[model samples]
Structure formats: structure tokens, C-alpha cells
Target: MRILALTSWWPEPANNGSRLRIANLLRALAQKHEVHLVSFRQEAVSAQQIQRMLRICASVDVVPQRVWRPQPGEQIVSLWRSEPASVRATWNPEFAARVGERATDARPDVVVAFQIDTAPYALHVARAPRLLEELEVGNIHAHYVNQTSTHRRLRAWLTWRKHASYVQRLLRHFDACTVVSDNEQQLVRRIAPEMEAIHVLPNGADVHGCARDWGSPEPDTLIYPGALTYDANFDAVKYFISEIFPRVRHVRPGVRFVVTGAAPPELRVALPQAEGVHFTGYVDDVRSLIARSWCEVVPLRQGGGTRLKVLEALALGTPVVSTPKGVEGLDLKQDEHVLIAQTPGEFAAATVRLLEEPELRSRLASAGRQIVAQKYDWSSIGQRLVDLVAALAPHTVVQSKRHLPGQISV
Candidate 1:
């Protein structure tokens, strides 16, 4: 079978959670079928990165991402468009033409689009069974509505209406859809109630890489392994630094907090300068950094879907201290798989306890790793994506026997 996988950006050297999902899913599909990848180049994708894709993809095409920003006095023009700037910016004619041209020649059995932005491109693949992968729209709904500013609230309301309407229209075109969590599934349902076939394809980690011990966690240290480039991650780091880290530091002055991922210098300026807080900008391998931590702290007050950060930490036997929202859609139990704390005071107290009580840390780490092995391993989750695609295009399956490990026998 031939599969055309569409993404907003090239998903090579998948250093981040979103990239990791597409990379793994495409690799899974490539094991049994031909996968042609067409994506937008958001940044300079290194030759090594393209080589990584060549290992999994039969062919790859990356065009420059559509660069669109509201010019001075374009507010009226943007409003007249009746769609959010996000949707307007990603509407690339070059990408659409490329996808259409490939779909004409390849005539893929399946078309999987990575996000809401790329879903429109998948719709152009007129005959294939389109799977809207990881269409997590909850992030758009999670912002700006609660602000005190009247202008901001009004803008957010308009943005929400336009974006929701656009997505609802797009959802109707796809044969099936997948979200990272049940929470995201519900968010998509809320927008397109009449639509069906939305599956929960969870966020996961490479547990195979976690087979060997990821080294003993360093004492008096806590880590959060998400990049500050994303707004939610930056917000999480800021919140931890401002409200939670200070409390943790007050309790244990020698404790260190490490944030791993690329931190743009501009974004770094906003984070409160503190003594024990350290940011390692852009790590090639974050698992080592995660494994050597005493605890993984996810003080996320924003964002939607299950956190790959949590799953990766659990996979590495790193006990975690997270807010309820941080573990929102995960199959985790409080004090069993993780230590749940809602307030800054509670989060700090939990972090201190995880650091101080070796017994508790060991227990949580064991429980968390067990949970990840059963549910959040990339191999299992990648197979689930294959199952969904197979289910969508069952005609592609010719036998009762399976071709790949964990295949659905479709």
C-alpha cells in the first residue's frame, strides 16, 4: 500500500513530542507500505535530518512554510477573511499543489494529515481514506477568554468563533481522526458533534530505548524536558519559577531545577532569573537529561492532550510531581503513578518529599515505569495508528495474517 503522510513541518530528528509522534507513525507505516512524505520546512532541516527521514520515507518533499503576518492596518482585512490568522498563514498553495500532484501520480491508499493546519491539504486527496492525525484543537480553546481586557476578550471570542467554525468544516471532510487524549477527543466532538470515527491515539515514548537503566537520578535535582519555544512550555517554566520553584527552593536551598530544550534568548529574558534554575537550550538527546534527574516536575497550567514529557519520564524510571492538569488525560493514579499537587504550595511540598524520601521516589518511579510499559510505549501506540489506518482502508489488507508486529490483522 502507498500512504501519503502530510505534515505542517518536516518531522525529522524528532526532538519534540509532536515530531516524535509523526516520525514513529510514519516509520510504522513504512515497515509494510510505501510512505511518501510532503511537508513544509519551518526551519533549516539539516542533511542529517533528511537522512533520518530517508531511513523511513520512500520519498520526501519539503517546501518553505507559508510566511504570513498581519501587516500594519490589516486588522480589517483579517476580520474580513472570517478565519483566524493561524489558518490564513498556513494555507500554502505550493504545498496544496504538491500534495495534489503527488496524489494524482501515487494514488495513495491512505492520506494522513498531522494537524488541523494540514487537514485542508488532505481533503484535496479526493479518493483516499483520509486520517486526520493528532488534530488536537483544545489548545485554541484554552486561551485568552479569561483575560480582563475587553479588547483581548473580544479578539479571543472572534478568534475562537472563526477557528472553531473552520475546523468543524474541515472535520467533516476526513474519513477518520485521531487525538492524543480523551480530552482532545471531546474537544473535537464539541466542535463537530455529528462526526464519528475519532480515535484516541495517545502520546508515547521510545520505551525500547528505556530498556537499559537510564542511570541513577541525580539527587537534589528536578527536570522538565520541554522546549521554551512553545507558549505552554514557556508558561509552565515561568509558573514553576515564579510560584512553585521558589517554594521548593525555600524548603531545600540546595535543590536544583533543570529545564532542557531550546530556549530562545528573547523568551529566556522573561523567565525569572534564579540561583538554582538552569536551562539547557536544545538537547540532541533529552532522555539522558531526564533519566539523571531526581524528579520530573510538570507544573503545566496550560495546554491540552496527554504530555509526552510525563510518559518519557515514567519510561525512564524518573518519578514525577505534576499538577492534575499536567496529567489530565493520562491513565495515571495519584500517589500511585505520580504525586499530584494542585497549588504552588502543594507542588513544592510534593517535590520536596520526592527528593527527601528515597523510598517514595523508588515506589513512584517503579509504578510510573510499569504504567508506561503497558500503555504509552511508542511501538504499541504506533501500531494503534496502523490499526486505525488499516480499519479505514480495509481493502488494502489481503490476508488474515499480520505483516508487522502488533498489526490488527486487518
Candidate 2:
């Protein structure tokens, strides 16, 4: 079957969780089906990165998007008029047009949109069984709204309201939807209760790629790998550095905390200047970093969905200390597959315990690896996705109406 997968970003050499998930999904899907990927490339990506993404997918097309920032005058006007700075005009009409043209020619059996932003393009395609993969609900924006100051909170609230409406509207148009975790699926059901088909397809890792020797002793380091620009990751790192790291240092001054990922300029500036904290902007081999770490810490407080970092850490047989939110989607047992901690104090305590008790760490690591092998491996998860697409296809029929100009039709 020919499948057109739409995503906001395509994985390349970059260490991005979303890109990695999408790439793994596409690669697995490509094994049985002819998969074509269309992704939106932001300015940070290069030509080499595009080529790398192409190599992973059967065919790849990218729509270049420029990050638009409001002018100083526009910002002032927004403040007075009570509008958001995030407002930007879509400039890639040709990309949408090309997708529609491709849909007509390729006549794919299925269309899958990876995120809410790409849903609009997929919705325009009227001739295929459409699946919207909602990795996370917009609940993070609500969290941000609570975290922001009064002035910012009002703007965030307004922006979130608009976005929520847009998502609900799009949800009705798709034949089926899939989310990374049960938590996100529940949230979707609450908002769009009428939607019959909502599947919980948890995030998965490349277990084969992550397999390594667990017998070798690792360095006394804790690693946190994720995109720093994301609020959840930024908050996790900030909480660790400000509240948890200090306590951990007092207990074990020799242990190092490594923060590894692509950081925005603002997050980069806020890095702790302490002796034990090492802020590596981006690294090519995140697995090597995980392999060398004593334990992986996932202190995410404000995000919905299953974290790939947790899966990757577990896949590498690295003991993980994370919040309940961090391990929400997976079937993990506390003190076995992973250590679940909520507060900063509990998180620090768990980290220290894992670092000190080698036997406990070993037990947790073994259990975690077993969990990944059983459930979160890419091959297993991908087969489930393939089955869903096949099941939905027989009931799906192509509509004759052409989508509006600049719209994507699946």
C-alpha cells in the first residue's frame, strides 16, 4: 500500500525525540508498505540534514518554513490589542498544493499526519483513510499559561483557546486518531467525546540500536537527553539544577549531571554555572552518553505523552529515575522497571539511591530492558500501527469534492 506520512520535522543526524519517533515509524512502515514522507523543515535544518532524512524514507519532500518573529511595533500593538506574538501567516501554499497533486497521482491507501500542525494539510486530502497521530494534547500550553505572569497568561489563554478549537474541528475530519499514551487518549476523548476511534499507540525505541553490554561499569554521571527548547525539558533541567542538583551534590560531590540536547538561546543562557553540571549543546551519539551514565533522570513536570528518553534509557539497560508523568504511557512498575518520583526531594533521593546501590540499579536495569523488549520495541509497535491502517482502509471511501485552494487532501 502507498502511504503518505506528514510530519512537522524529519529525523536526520539531529537528536530530536519527535523526529526520531517519526523516522522509526516510517522506517518500520516502509518494510511492508511504500511510504512517502512530507515534512516541514525549519531554518535550523541544512541540506545535508534533508539528504539524511531522504535516505531514511522511501521518498521525502520538505516545505521550508521561516520562523517569523513580530516586529517591535507589532509586539507593542499586540500588547495593546491583547494578541499573541505567535501569530504567523502560513507561507507555504505551494507545499500544500504539491501534496494535493501528489495525492491525486499516487492515490495512497492511507494518510497519516504526525502532529496537530500538519493535520490541516492531511485533512485536505479527501481520498484516503486519514490518521492524525496526536503525540501530546495541548495541555502543555495550559501548563505554560499557569506558569506565565499575569500579562503573558492572558495571551497564552487566548492562544490556547484558538488552538483547542482548531484541534477539535480537525479531529472530526479524520477517520481515526492515535496518541502516544493513554493519558493523551483520555484527554482527546474528553474534548471530542463523539469520536469513536481513538487508539493508544505508545512511543517506542529502537531496541536493537540501543542494545549494549550491561556488564561494563558506567561513569558516575546522570544524563538528561531532550530538546531544551521544549518547556517540559527546560523545566526538568531547571528544576534539577536549581532544586535537585544542589541536594545531590551535597550527598555525592563527585557525580556529574550532563544536560545534553539542542537548546534555544534563552535556555542556553540559563544553564547553571556549578561545578558538576555540564551543558553540552548537542551531541552526535546520545546512546554513548546514556551508556556511560550511572543513571538516566527524567524530571519532566509539565508534558503529556510518553517520553522517548525514558524508553531509550530503558532500552539501553540504564536504570532510570523519573516522575510519574515521565513514565505515564508505559507499563512500568515502580522500584522495578523504573523509579517514580514526583517532588524534587523525592527525585534527588531516588537518583542518589540509584547511584549508591549498584544491586538495586542492576535489578531496575534488567527489568526495564525486559519491558522494552516486550512492548516498546519499534518493530512490535509498528506492526500494531500497520494493522490499524489496514483495518480502517476497508471502511474508508474517497470523497469527490476537491479541497479548498491551499488545502491538503488525504
Candidate 3:
């Protein structure tokens, strides 16, 4: 079977969660079928990266992403021509034409759009079953920004409404859709109730890389690893510094917090200066930090979908204390796989308790690792994606019956 996977960018060296998801999904598809990747290349892709794709993919076509801001007349014409928000005009117009040309020659059996921005190109391929993978409900994040913004609140609110409308319009076109969690699936349905076949394809981690026995932890060390430049993560770090970490330090004076991930100067300045707070600008691997930590903290106030950070921590057998919003969409129970806290004081208390009580930390770490190994490994999640695609394009190829060692059969 020939599958055309469309993405907004080349998903190689998938250091981030979103790119990791697409890379793993394509790896799964490539195992059983011919996968031709046609994606936008925002920057010059490294030769090593293209070679990585060449190893797994049948062929790859990279469409150069260029800047295109329309003038007043062009903006009017764009609004008249498409239901998508005007911001989408920035997408290379030649993308759809390129996809059309490929479809004419390669004749793909199915088209899978990895993100909402690339759905228009996938939908343009009329004969194939179009599958849209919604990483998260974009409007939900837009709403979060709206609720949190001060000076730009009105602009954020308007953007949220526009994205909501765009989602409703796009939802009606796809044959099937998948989101990162049940919570996001419900959000999509609420926004567009008439649509069916919207499924929950939860986020996962590379358990094999993370499923290991953590060595002796550094006493009183807490780690928070994520894309710190993202609004929610930046806010989470700031919230911890402002409201949560001080409370923890008061209880445990030696407690030190490590904020690790990519960050901009603005995000860095947003974090309050404190004696115990340390920031690692970017990390190639967070497992070392997680392994050496007394516990991992996720004090997220606003974010949608399940957190890969939580999954990665759990897979590493690192005890985790997170806010209810932090672990949203994951099937985790308080005191079982993780310790959930809603308020800053509660979060701080959870952190201090995990630090002081060795037995509690051990129990949570063991349970969390067991949960991810059993349910959230990449192989199992990849197979789930395959199952959905198979159902949509059953005539294309027979679904593989094989599963990874720890993977549950799809």
C-alpha cells in the first residue's frame, strides 16, 4: 500500500513531543506499507535528517515553506476563497499544487494529514481516504491564551473564535480524525457535534529508552522538563517560581528546582530569580535529570491534551507530582501512578511529601513505570494509528498482526 503522509514540517530528529509523535507514527506505517512523505521544509533539513527519512520512507518530497503575507485585495480574495482563517494564507500556496501533482503520478491509496494546517492539501486528494490527526484542539489552547493574556486579551479571544470556526469547517471534511486524548476528542465533538469517527489516539513515549531503574536520586532535587518557550510551559515555570516553589522551600529549605528545555529570553526573564532555581537552556536528553531527581514536578495551570513530559517521567520510573490540569487526558489515579494537586500549596505539599517519604516515592515510581510500559509505549500507540488507518482504507493493505514485546495487540 502506498500512503502519502502530509506534515507541516519534516519530522526528523524529533526532539519535541509533536515531532516525535509524527516520526514514530510514520515509522510504524513504513514497517508495513510504502510511505511517501510530502512535507513542508521550513528550514534547510540537515543531510543526516533526510538520510534518516530515506532509511524508513519509500520517498520524500520537501516543499520549501516561504513567507507570503497578502495585501488588502489578496486578503479579501483569500477570505472569499477559503473557510480557513486568514493566517493560513502564510502556508505555501504551491503545497496543494505539489500534492496534486504527486497524486497524479504516485497514486497514493490514502492521505494522512499530520496537522490541521496541512489538511487542505490532504482533502484536495479527492479519491483517497483523508485522515486528519489533530495533535490537540487548537482553539482550546487559543482559549487558554485568551484567558491568561492581559493586554492582548481581545486579540487572543478573537483568534480563539476564528480557530474554533476553522476547526468546525475542517472537521466536516475529513473521513476520520484522531486527537491526543479523550478530553480533546470531547472538545472536538462539542465544537462540531455533527461529526463522527473522531477517535482518541493518546500520546506516548519511547518506553524502551526510559523504562529503566533510576539510580540513587539527588536529595531535594526537583525537575520540570518541557518546551519552556511554549506559553503553557513558560507559565508553568513562572507559576512554580512565584507561587509553588517558595512554599516547597519553606518546608524543605534544601530543595532545588531544575527547569530544563528550550527557552527564549522573554521566558527566562518571566521566571522569578531565586537561590535554588536552576535553568538548563536545552537538553538532548531529560532522562538523566529525571533519574537523578527526588521527583518531577508539573505545575501546569493551562494546557490541553495529555502531557508527553508526564509520560516520559513515568516511563523513566521517576516519581511525579502534577497539577490536575498537568496530567489531564491521562488515565492516572492520584496516589497510584502520580500525585495530583490542584493548588500551589497542595502541589508544594505533594513535592515535600515525595521528598521526605522514600517509601511513597518508590511506590509511585514503580506504579508509574508499570503503567506506561503496559499502556503507553510507542509501539502500542503506533499500532493504534495503524488500526485506524486500516479501518479507513481496508482495501489498501492488510493490517499487521505483529506487536512489540511489551505492546498490547491492536
Candidate 4:
């Protein structure tokens, strides 16, 4: 089976959650079938990264990424459009032309759009069964309920209504769709109650890669493996540094907090000041830091899909202490697979408890690792995606012979 995949993210620098998911899923699809990746080049993907991708993908094609920045009048004008303003804004004629041409020449059996961001392009792929992979709409809905001010709530509600209607309308273009968790699956059902075949496919980690010893755990240390560039992650760390960490510091003065990822200078400078807060800017492989930490902290207040940080931490045999919202859409059980805390006080207590109780850490670590290996490992989870997409075209024979570079465009 020949497959064409569209992505909003450049799967290189698989450092972030989005890239890693897209890269691994493509690899999985390419294992038994030829996969042609038509991805938006969100950044400068190195020659090394390009070569790595070609090893799995038959050919990799990239279109320049154009972010849709809503203009002043766009919101008011969107009220008159059939689709959301962002949807109209996202349509790139060059990307559409290229995708149509490629799909026509390659004659793929299935077309996969990685996220809703890529759906506009995927829609241009003529006469192929489409699969909407990792479609997430829950986080938008979360904003409506979580907003504090009435104005913010009303704004979020309006945004939610727009996106909800857009999502429902978008479902008409695909044969099937997948989301990260049962929670998201439920959200999709509620939004589009008549929509069927929504698969719950959570984000995965490289379990075997993390299972390797990266050295002993660092004493009195906690890690949050996410970049401060993302709002949720930035909010999480700020929430921790301002509210939760101080509480934990009162009990355990020596405890350290480590955050890994690139930080914008302004955002970095604006971060709340605190002792023992270290940010390792953009690690290519964060597994060592994760494995070396006493535990991983995820105080995420908002995000789409499941978090790979929690999954990767579990894979690294590190116990996780997360807010209920942090672990939303994951298979983790509170206190068993991970420790769940809702508020600043409870979160600080959970962090301190994990630090003090070595036996509890070991227990959660063992349980977490086991669960990740069984359910959240990329090898298994990736294959599940492959099987799901393959099911779309059951009768097609998978083309096993590798295509020579001379035989097709690379």
C-alpha cells in the first residue's frame, strides 16, 4: 500500500512532542508500506535529519510553512464564511497543487493528515480514503470551562463554538479519525455525536530507548521535560515556581527543578525567579535527564492530545507527579501509575512525598515503566496506527520492494 502523509510539523528535532509523534508514526507506516511524506517545513531541517527521514520515507517533500495570523477584521469577517476563518486562512494554493499532483502520480491507497492543521491540504488529495490521525479538540473545550473572567470565558466559549462547528464539519471529509485519549474520544462524540470510528490512539514514548540506564537518579531533583516556548509548559513551570515549588522548598530546601527546552529570551527573562530552577535549553535527547531525575513533574493546565513527557518519564523508569489536567487523555491511574494532584498545595505535597519515600518512588517507577512498555511504547503504538490506517484499504497488497531513488522523486 502506498501512503501519503501530511504534517504541520517538521519531524526532525524530534525533541518536541509534536515532531516525535509525527516522525515515529511515519516510521511505523513506512515499515510495511511505502510512505511519501508531504510535510510543512516548520523550521530548517538539517541534512542529517533529512537523510534520517529518507531512510524510512520513500520520499520527503516539504512546503514552506505559513502561519495564519488572524487580522483585525478576520474574526468579524469569519462570521460570514462557511468554514472557520482559520481554515480559509490555512489554505495554501501551492501546497494543494503539489499534494494533488503527488497523489495523482503516486496513486496512494490511503491519505493521512497528522493533525487538524494539515486537514486542509489532505482534503485536496483526490480519490483516496482519508484518515485523520491525532485529531484533538478537547483542549479548546477545556478553555471555555477553565477561564476565570467572564469576558475570557465568553471569548473562549465563542472560540470553542467556532472550532466545534469546524471540527464537526471537517469530519465529513475523512473516513476515520483518531484522538489521544478516551476523554478526547468522548469530546468528539459529544461535539459530533453521529460521527463514528473514532480511535483512541495516545502519544507514545521510546520505551526501550528510555529503559536503558542513563546513570543513577540525581538526588533531590525533579524534571519537567518541555520547552518554555509552549504556553502550557511555560504556564506549568511558572505555576510550579510561583506557587508549588515554594511550598516544596519549605519542606525540602535542597530539592532542584530542571526544565529542558528552548526558551524565548523575553519569556525566559519574564519567568518567575526562584532557587534551584535550571533550564537546559533544547536537548536533542532528553532521555538521560529524565532517567536521572528523581521524578517528572507535569503541572500542565492546558494542552491538546496526551503528553509525551509523562509517557517518556514512565518509560525512563521515573515516577511522575502531575495535575489531573496534566495527565488527561492518558491511561495512567492516579497513585498507581502516577501521582495525581490537583492544586498547588496538593501538588507540592505529592512532590515532597515522592522525594522522601524511596519505596513509593520505586513502586510507582516499576508500575509506570511496566504500563508504558505494555501500552505506550512507540513500537506497539506506532504499529497500531499502521494497522488502523491499513484497515482503511484492506484489500490492497502492500508493496514490500523498496523503491530505488532513480525510480522515483526523493
Select the stronger candidate by TM-score from 1 and 3: 1
Supply the TM-score for candidate 2: 0.86
User: What ordering of candidates by TM-score runs from best to worst?
Assistant: 4, 1, 3, 2
Q: Each model's RMSD to truth, in Å?
A: 4.2, 5.4, 5.3, 1.7
In model 3, the clashing pairs are none
lDDT of 3 at 19: 78
Model 2 accuracy (lDDT, Cα): 0.76
TM, every model: 0.92, 0.86, 0.88, 0.96
Error of 1 at 250 (Å): 2.3
Candidate 1's residue-wise lDDT over 1-410, tens digit each?
A: 77888987578667877778877788778776777788887788776777667667666777788777767766556777866766776588888988998788778889999977788889889878898998877776877555578988887777777788888888788888998888888888998998888899898888888768667667898999888988889999999999998888888999999999989899999899999989888888888888999899999988877888899899988999999989988999999999999998999999999988999988998998899999998888888887788888888853332232221100
What tens-digit string does per-residue lDDT give for candidate 2 at 42-112? Answer: 65566666555555445667777546766766654654442244433444676687678767766788998
Error of 3 at 315 (Å): 0.5
Candidate 3 TM-score versus the reference: 0.88
Q: Lowest-lDDT window of 10 residues in candidate 1?
A: 401-410
Candidate 3 per-residue lDDT over residues 247-310, each given as its tens digit: 9999899989998888788767767888798888778767888888979999887767678889
Candidate 2 runs further than 4 Å off:
43-58, 68-88, 141-157, 263-266, 395-410
Q: Score each candidate by Cα lDDT.
A: 0.83, 0.76, 0.79, 0.86
- Which tens-of-lDDT digit does each residue in 47-100 have in candidate 4? 777777787877777778778898998777777667778778777777777788
Predicted model with the maximum TM-score: 4
